[model samples]
Target: MGQSAIGTKMITQIGILVHDIEAVSEAYANFFGVDKPAWNWTDTPDKAQTEFLGEPSQARAKLAFIDMDSLQLELIEPDFHPSTWRNYLEEHGEGPHHIAFVIEGMKEKIAIMESKGMKLQQKGEYTGGRYAYFDSIPQLKVLVELLENDK
Candidate 1:
């Protein structure tokens, strides 16, 4: 078999959306035999209303950032209004939500995905990094995200 041209990039993070934050976080902590993540709460700003696709409301999410070697595992629980994470929990229950790949040429890659009929779910910047969400593998029920750090 010939090698493919697509080179493997570093997986910076994996995000999991869970209904119960404590339970899920504990499970991962025990499984990985690592320290529990430091918790933080994030609120969507009212001024940033244009970012939300559905309603004009501020959503709250509890994030636990766990460091595992060079990669970070983020476990998120949507506490306020329903978001993509909440919707995923409602539809598929608690599980892996998205795989984040850190790479260069984000805009070019997004354009390529769009040209290939992949739908763009969301795109924005957070904490000096840019992220773009794409539709899941139809029948597989998963999301793929391309993350680029400006730092």
Candidate 2:
């Protein structure tokens, strides 16, 4: 096999979309014998600078993170806004949304994925980092998210 286009094999997070974040997060915590985590909303569009399908979007979602040994399991409940999360939930119902990897060079990595025919879907900034999602379902059976944290 050739070098990975994203240049990383470590999947840092698995994002799952649900209709109710609190209910689902509690269920997961109980199932895993861990404490239910507090859920928070993604930053607003003004702070996140969110874009969906190359256009500015005001999408947001409730997010909860459950920490495991090597990766975190994320539960997402999207708002009515137009975003990858909302679209996936409406079209496919609740289920796994994307697998994320920690990375550097956000722009270059995005370009690499695009070269491989994976169209960029959504991107946004967070408090200490930024994220980009690629439409990788046709190739990987799931969306791919790249997280680049500031040093």
The top-ranked prediction according to TM-score is 2
Q: If scored against the real structure, what TM-score would every candidate get? A: 0.76, 0.98
Q: For candidate 1, which ten residues in a row score worst on lDDT?
A: 46-55
**Model 2 lDDT, residue 28, Cα:** 96
Clashes of each: 0, 0
Candidate 1: misplaced stretches above 4 Å?
1-8, 46-57, 80-82, 139-141
List, residue by residue over 1-151, the lDDT tens digit for candidate 1: 6531113456778888877778878888899897666677763454224134434445557889888888888898976564566667788887888877776777887777677566666565555566676775673366877877786
What's every prediction's RMSD, in angstroms?
A: 3.4, 0.7
lDDT of 2 by residue, 39-151 (tens): 99999889999999999999999999999999999999999989999999999999899999999999999999999999999999999999999999999999999999999
Misplaced by over 4 Å in model 2 are none
TM-score for predicted model 2 compared with the true structure: 0.98
